[model samples]
Target: MKKLVISLALCATNSLFAQQNWLGNTSPTYEELIAHLQQLDRSHKEVKLYNMGPSDYGQPIYLCVVNGHRDSSETFEKARQSTTILINNAIHPGEPDGINACLIWLDQWIRAGKPLKSHDGGDLPVIAFIPAYNVGGMYNRSSTSRANQNGPEEYGFRGSTKNLDLNRDFTKMDAVNTYTFVKIFQALDPDIFIDNHVSNGADYPYTLTYISSMKERLAPSMQALTYAHCIPTIKDYCQIGNFELFPYVELKGETPEEGIVAFNDLPRYAMGYASLFHSLSFTVETHMLKPFPERVKATLQFMNATIAYAIGNAERIEIARKEAIQWSQAQTYFRFNYQMNEQVKDSIRFKGYKAVYPIHPITGLAQLEYDRKQPYEKYIPYYHFYISQDSIAVPKYYIVGGQETKVIASLKANGVEFQTLDSFETKTVTCQFVKSYKAPTRPYEGHFKLSEIEIASSEQAILLKPGDILIPAQQERAYFIHAVLQAKAEDSYFTWNFFDSYLQQKEYFSAYVFKAQIEDLLSKNPELKKSYEEKKALDIKFAQSEWDQLFYIYQRSPYFEQTFMRLPVYELND
Candidate 1:
């Protein structure tokens, strides 16, 4: 009887985990979630789970991989021609909803064994899951015994302790331990990717924000199906802000870096890494400060809808994504996407480029000419570089961590003066409350209001004391860091960088035009040129280099068969 009881208990335990406990109302702790994933891995050999490496706070992050093709799922093909889909959640533990939602998604695709009927019985695509991208921040113990962080942030535990916003690191890639995992991910070229995050505060902003760095016309069509099937809760709450929230929208011609494609928007870093290397990607955001259940529901809706959208339109999206590759090849002004504003009173101003020069990836150099013709006043004359996409020159402003002083000093040597002041020490407070009477007037519950309070940095108490505002617990962003930067053409390296980038960036802007524009030629206008034969040879060399790297990877995998399918479609013929 004792033997039989123990055996039955073991079976029961296994069976219990197999059930769909992920999306359920009862939340699971980090350990519980990890254990459940392990248990599921046993049943689904297709799902591979790994730790991207532990966090500074001593928590092991769980990264799950789901190979898309049935035939190539297990063994490595000669050409590891696979598209990786990386999704992560819970950078801030209090925003555990995204993590749970991701778990629910894992359960649906892995255990529920959803049929591929939608794919015409084709193999599903592979996925590289970083469900809790911010494991350390999310799992670190809060002042309260709560499983995840909750807000009225000042009321939440360790409210300001999570100073390292992982989102900002996308372009910077400065995190060492993180680079180890990132290097592995880099090896596998991902086709599509998304990073999940929760938004804080009163309005509980509902809309999904895609990195607006993508070309305008294609952005909507690419995300078409995703918006279709979202659960009403998320769909109803959805607000479509591509690159940024306020500045990018309100200021005409301002080519602000709000999307993932910029220096390193974390989502942009991940997605842009995929896109630049030739793949499709996404960055996901869900409002966090709203009621807990609401956030989870919306996140899950977004996830499921996204998966379903990918599955349903896999063939179509694949073609559209491929078209993007073609579009990228023949374009000029390749860096920023420009939107012309007609609301100006008189003389049409030069708004910023919709895109900017592509980063060299290694040297971290983004020297560009100061385009006097740039549309946005704020964006003019200054070139941009992100350590990862969202993070600006961290070393120059404040000591977020590590040694960034040199990075700041370099910019200053170039004449960019910025400062990082702690809220407690510096008394210059600029917390403004703007009133809105828009029809959708969200009863404005205030967020971003930072107050002063005295509290020990112990893990026992809620991170902040009463009356403390939610300003930077040392988190900083001040755009107007320095005074006006006006300079003449001859003395400025910005002029050279800008002209060089301007020529190399566009498909037609050639080396011939590059110099002639400053000298012989008159037209600085982007439209007048149709094609350039002078730089045709150079462009081919650059394009061939990109193609060769891609083909080299495909040559080594079971996907070598695809080479025949893809190779014959040589773009060189044109």
Candidate 2:
């Protein structure tokens, strides 16, 4: 009877462990995930969970720290001081492989007595992960959202409660979740960062894919470490785990056979945001068609590999990041507007299924589909090289207008150091005027995003008031400062519609009212009169239209508002 009782107890314990361990194609709901993590925190001294801040859903976003110091405060401090790896999960909650992977990692770590050293006997880096980033999306759970994804019995939606894509809110920081994320990110100052995801594209055999920071955007030391060491080492490590890893299949053409291109990690992306701060960043994208269990395991393998790499190369990673930060601070020119060089291409061994166009039985229309039976291995063109189309000379300081509260908040959230003016002052600074731009007809992520922006700069004496921010460019976050402050950058505040108000002509004069002043305005300035006469002589449109001629003079005259079309950001050159 005693033996039987003991055996029954052992079986029950094993069953409980099996349930906790993510063994199937299901991810936990937000509450379930947090509860499980709370349990882990309660049970283990090595695990610590902190309620970092609130998400858009009014729920507290939590951060789980593993292999840290004794207390929560110490753990965070140690994370900032030591080599750390941060894994972000469920930014797109539909891609919940990372959530399960992290849970499984915790279970395995606990089972192994929570080893604090890697297999090679090096000290383990502080491992941290946000169990579920999009708490709002996590609450809006369903199976039908990700129509192409295979087997997560149920999962969260891609958009937050506000119907915003959290991934794109990193730089603009429109979502409350982004503020919380920035808080978590700044607190940790992690050496390595990974944002897990799932890919939706042409069929591929590989279960997992990865996107690294664009090579052209990274500091030289980080570029070398990421390309020369981390990725290759992690690839080898993943191979040892009986899986294949490949670059994300951002296609050059519609089908895999055509070719693949490297992902352009803009500042709006999570990985790209982290990269700006000199963190070795990556985005893991498992194939959508693969089973969730398989994807979860692959994600787990990647986490393990990344942690292993961090452990082995902690010193090198630290040194490289330090060097990268210093390199950013000492830079004289910041290059951006990266365009992929199509002429320069490298070949990679790609495994893909033949794309077939077959008539649908119901629709009776030919639809593109991947033929699973026709899997092929071949060398495909991989266009990975990028060249900067624009460069700006670094400025000593950037002065943001006091009225730009939202922009200042975002800068502060990203831990940018700045001095706030207590009194009004005037300084000669370089100011940008919007030369031209185009806005999309439709709203994207709640914004009529501006693009194709052209800017013209002039040195002007500007009055700075109290609360105006003066941010020095020579700092650790110099790259981030430049990426957003520069008017023409791909993901600048201007591009994201932050400066939309400045683009509009706020105080406009009617054609009839302005006509009376044109003669007197042009007569007061001889150069203006000469130019007006030259325009009338040279151009038929100007000569033919009385309103155009008068309006041109009105625009050139002092009556026109100087602040119209002028960006609030000003630069002080060294």
TM-score winner? 2
Q: At residue 440, what lDDT does model 1 achieve?
A: 22
Best by lDDT: 2
- C-alpha local distance difference test of each model: 0.39, 0.91
lDDT of 2 by residue, 107-196 (tens): 878777788876668998899899999999999999999999997999999999999999998898989999999998998999999999
> By summed lDDT, which 10 consecutive residues of candidate 2 come out lowest?
11-20
For model 1, what is the alpha-carbon lDDT of residue 341?
27
Worst 10 residues of 1 by lDDT: 565-574
Q: Residue 392 in model 1: shift from native, Å? A: 21
Candidate 1 lDDT, tens digit per residue, 48-141?
Answer: 6765565655666666666542433233231135334556555455556666666666666644564534446544556566665555554554
Clashes of 1: 57
lDDT of 1: 0.39
